[model samples]
Target: MVFFKYPEQIRRVMYTTNTIEAIHRQFHKLTKTKVRFSKQNNLLKLLYVGIKNASTKWTMPFPNWNLAVSQLAICFEELLDATLDL
Candidate 1:
């Protein structure tokens, strides 16, 4: 857990791969029934719809986001500010 070096608030934000894994699982579920798509757009559209449906449940905000951002700003002061125009 390389993220362990960060504070608890930041660790919670960084530690989980669940969201990405869930998205992959959704894509798998969407695509597994078909061996081939006749057109590239069809596959892309399916994945896009799957992502849209999965993202509908993402209404909740992360906890302690401001604190985590402050911590990140301290740790990556020059990089974060320069990247985000903060």
Candidate 2:
């Protein structure tokens, strides 16, 4: 399969959809308690604050990230080269 072509480290990162789902769940939780917003900007501000707080918790980098990047570069040499050129 196409997925099997990548290294194990890359595969692990690829299967981390739960992290995204957790962020969405957190966003829902943050908005759920607030029934009404005075203006559209107020709702936006709340979401912006939520994002900022969530980002702070993401300080940890992926394990073996350099190895994953190396594997990805090998798998998509042309693509990475093109991106780096721009």
Best-fitting candidate, scored by lDDT = 1
The lDDT for every candidate, in the order shown, is 0.86, 0.82
Estimate the Cα RMSD of every predicted model relative to the unseen true structure: 2.3, 2.8
- What residue pairs are clashing in model 2? none
TM-score, candidate number 1: 0.75
**On a 0 to 100 scale, what is the lDDT of residue 28 in model 2?**
98
For model 1, the superposed segments whose C-alpha errors exceed 4 Å read: 17-19, 83-86
Q: Least accurate stretch of 10 residues (summed lDDT) in model 1?
A: 9-18
Q: Which residue segments of model 2 deviate by more than 4 Å?
A: 1-5, 17-19, 82-86
